[model samples]
Target: MDEAARLGLVERYIAAYNRFDVDGMLALLAPGIRFENHAGGQLTAQADGIDGFRQLAEHAAALFREREQRVIARRSEAGRVVVEIAYRGVLAADIADGPKAGSVLEMTGRSEFAFADGKIGLIVDRS
Candidate 1:
């Protein structure tokens, strides 16, 4: 895909995530997409396909109750898109019980996206 198309796809992915649109977000990933959160020690290794991506998204949504998540900045370079985001949200349940539930906490994180075929092929995130 051209650079413009790639950037547009990245924007769509962010929009879908902010809206908690699991299906929409998954649609913007390649079949063998890999998502990683280095700081959190989390990785969704080569989510087999779109179906697998959807499953991951569903599981993630069930863990957090996001009040708001916004992209503070985004830039594209060397065939990759980088985004800085600010998020405020609360856990859905107790950490030991299931998922931790508590007052909203603010977080800032950066995500790097590698685009291919007008979709995200790899995502590396850090806080």
Candidate 2:
């Protein structure tokens, strides 16, 4: 896809994510989509294919009462789109040893997007 179309697709995914709309987000993903989440230089979670991603997305929706991922910038790099993001979230439930409910989580992250047939195929998120 062209750069504009690619960016639009990614933006749509982000919009769905902020809305916690799993199906909306899934619609923009390729059937064989791969998702990876990284934190503190460690791989935290991942899902392969639409079914796996859907489960992950649904579970995540319950963790955050509110969340936003604003695009800071985006650029084409080596046949992929790299997006700089500013993220904020308010937890809806507490983890055993993690942040408490109602706590604000803030971070800056970047995501690398790989497209397959005009849909998002691979997403590698780092924070």
Candidate 3:
């Protein structure tokens, strides 16, 4: 697929994520999708297939009362579209020793996406 089309898929995924619509996000993923999340240089999450990804997305959605991610910049490389992201979310639940519920969490990150059969087959998110 072309870069624009790939970027469109990513945007739709982010929109679905912002709305906490797990189904909507899953609809754009390939059946064999692979997803990974890295925070502070540590591997924080991973899901190997669509089913696994759905579970991960659902769980994540439940943790945020409200969230948004905007694509601030983008570049295409080696069949992947990498985009700089700005993220902001209000926590819905507190962690044992982490930020409390209702606290606003903000961060800058980047997502790399690879498409297959017009759907996202791989996604790596780092922040």
Best prediction by lDDT:
2
Model 3 TM-score, all chains together: 0.96
TM-score of 2: 0.97
The candidate with the higher lDDT, 1 or 2, is 2
My TM-score estimates for the predictions, one after another, are 0.81, 0.97, 0.96
Candidate 1: segments with Cα more than 4 A from true spot: 40-48, 97-100
Task: Tell me how many residue pairs clash in candidate 3.
Answer: 0
| Per-candidate clashes, comma-separated | 2, 0, 0
- For all candidates in order, the CA lDDT equals 0.76, 0.95, 0.93
Query: Which consecutive 10 residues in model 2 have the weakest lDDT in total?
Result: 74-83
For candidate 1, which ten residues in a row score worst on lDDT? 39-48
Which candidate achieves the best TM-score against the true structure?
2
Residue 113 local lDDT, model 1? 89
- For model 2, residues 34-100, the per-residue Cα lDDT tens digits are 9999999999999999999999999989999999999999998766889999999999999789899
